[model samples]
Target: MIVTRFAPSPTGRLHLGHAYSAILAHDFARRQGGRFLLRIEDIDGTRSRPEHVKTIIADLAWLGLSWDGDVVHQSQRLSAYAGALDRLREMGLLYRCYCTRAEIAAASLSAPHGAEPIYPGTCRVLTRQNAERPHCWRLDMARATAIAGPLTWQDHGRTIVADPLTAGDVVLARKDAPASYHLAVTVDDAWQGVTDVVRGQDLFAATHVHRLLQALLGLPTPAYHHHRLLTGPDGVRLAKRHGAPALAALREGGSNGLALATELRVGRVPIGATDT
Candidate 1:
């Protein structure tokens, strides 16, 4: 059976973009008689709040989307993340990173593919230590790619080559958080038997690293459908930082959730929505 999921981090309330993505995943699964799942990616305990998780569930339900079986929460899967990190450590593809944000910023150089600066791999050669020093875990990208050996994944019906090196050595586990999104999402997808990943194109670049992780971790690579992101009138991406209104707020303000969802399905903007 085909399985798909809408995994949302509960750092904030759900927005229009969130509603669209959830509807896309839910509709895709239900249309094909497959299973749609909901996952709460709340591993970042510092930012994740119990109330936000409740709000997310309420928002999705208000938007008329339902999932199959129990909801999966990332906080409950720390042991699995630790196990994956250990596996990477056992393969010598994991390293301790001790760089502070300022240090990494000083070394920031714009990546050719994206405006985001890639980590310069300063901590890749650092001596591994234990609890004495607080450090995050980073993937040895060069070594990891060498082991994976030319990987690729399907995206929107095309086989795209994975170039994880452009992302540099990504953090697999943080000093504060047990697992990074890249590690946790890949592990959970395989664990839940997710056959398809429907998300926004803003994450399209991240798929490169995800494919590499799937190869290294011996997990299945799910087909990806990276849809266009909902953008503001200024064309900037819709995000909480950009002051996008929450979907629940919109519904409370008298916007029709089903009408908005159908508009998104037909590649149109929601009614009274200033954002496209």
Candidate 2:
């Protein structure tokens, strides 16, 4: 059966943007006669809160989005992530990176525009003994990119492809954290049997890295649909920083679930338009 998921980091309440994504996933799954699943991306233990998770679940339920199975939490799957990292290590596709955030910031500032501080492969040459240092673990960008080749994944109305070698090595797991977003997301999507990824356009660039991870790890690459992101009246992306209203807040304001659904479907329908 076709499977899709709406994975959300429980760092904040489910805002309208989230609602649009979740509803899209739910509706798509239903249309395909497939299963829609929910996954809690609470890998960031520092900022993810139990309350936020609970609120996200409650809000999705209120929005009439139901799932077939229990929600999966990324934090509970550290060993799986470690296993993937170990496989890459055995293939000599992983190295240690000791650069601190400040150093990376300085390097980026020194680099020319359109060029992200392409990791200089500083730690890629570390000796086996040095690689054992607690602060090490970097991707072998050269090997990964070569293996990944020129790959493409589908997105809403467009196709995004990348050259693995040029995409740069991304951190899979940090010395302080067991799994980074890229690593965890790739694993979760594969394990959950997600056949399609429906998310915002803002993440289009990250798909390149995700595709690379899939290639390195031998996981199935899901079709990606990066839909338009919701924006506030100011034309900026809706975010908690700008106080973009959340679904729970709308619920608390006495808007029923159906009304909220209409709000989510607002822009697509012209004024005085009727549903056939």
Clash-forming residue pairs, model 2: 95-138, 96-137, 145-164, 145-165
> Cα deviation in Å at residue 156, candidate 2?
3.7
Clashes of each: 0, 4
Model 1 alpha-carbon drift over 4 Å, by segment: 111-115, 128-130
Candidate 2 lDDT by residue in tens digits, 1-276: 878899999888877778888888887788999999999998788889999998998888887789989999999999999999999889888867888766776665445675556666656676655555577477887787876677777776467766555546678888777888888999999999999988888777778888888987889988888878877655676666666677777777666766566666653322211111
List the global CA lDDT of all models: 0.87, 0.78
Q: What TM-score does each of the candidates earn?
A: 0.94, 0.88
User: Top TM-score: which candidate number?
Assistant: 1
lDDT for predicted candidate 2 compared with the true structure: 0.78
For model 1, residues 75-163, the per-residue Cα lDDT tens digits are 99999999999999999998888888778877886655536568898877656566568889999999999999998888889999999
lDDT of 1 at 229: 88
